[model samples]
Target: MVGYALALALPNGKFDIAHAARTPGDPVRRRPRGNALRKPAGILVVREADMDELGWYPNVETPEAR
Candidate 1:
């Protein structure tokens, strides 16, 4: 989900997944613009197969993994 958003946000569509994962932005609130909240709009469609190329690892083990 985040990868897709980053892909759209980046002009070249090249971003560091590790950096994004480590220093993530606020998920609940949108970015602020002056005194107004930035409009939350944009649609990105990512195919399941393309996720691997985007560095998405569904099976990667984490501390919470059991």
Candidate 2:
């Protein structure tokens, strides 16, 4: 199974998940509809194991040092 994270950027300079799935293939089933903040500003795909190290916040922007 693969892990996926879908983040949408908010007008307030923050990010939120539009949808998430761990299915064997195609994590996202349907395209998200656009909203006032605009839909699907960012999409991130991460291995299940790496999620612990990478963290969940897509807007955080982790440093290379880690």
Candidate 3:
């Protein structure tokens, strides 16, 4: 399973992962359908063990979803 992490640029000038979600695959690679954020940047803070079990990259989406 792959997961998602959100980083928010706030007034306080601090970066944080707001949300996390998981999907089946290495990662969910998706392009915005319309005019959304040009590119979303963030980080994956999950444990290495978790990734080993899931065997996912992070944000790589599948062919059907694309």
TM-score list, all predictions? 0.16, 0.19, 0.18
lDDT of 3 by residue, 1-66 (tens): 222323333222223332223323423332121113222353333222345566456868899669
The best candidate in terms of TM-score: 2
Flag clash pairs in model 3: 26-57, 27-60, 27-61, 28-59, 28-60, 28-61, 29-60, 29-61
The 10 consecutive residues of candidate 2 with the worst lDDT sum are 30-39
- Cα lDDT of model 2 by residue, 12-31, tens digit: 22334333333334443433
Q: Please identify model 1 stretches exceeding 4 Å from their true place.
A: 1-35, 38-58
lDDT value for model 1:
0.31
Q: Which ten residues in a row have the lowest lDDT in candidate 3?
A: 30-39
Return the top candidate by lDDT.
2
Residue 11 CA displacement from its true place in model 3, Å: 13
Decreasing TM-score order of the candidates: 2, 3, 1
Candidate 3 or 2, higher lDDT: 2
Candidate 2 pairs with clashing backbones: none
Model 3: lDDT of residue 46: 25
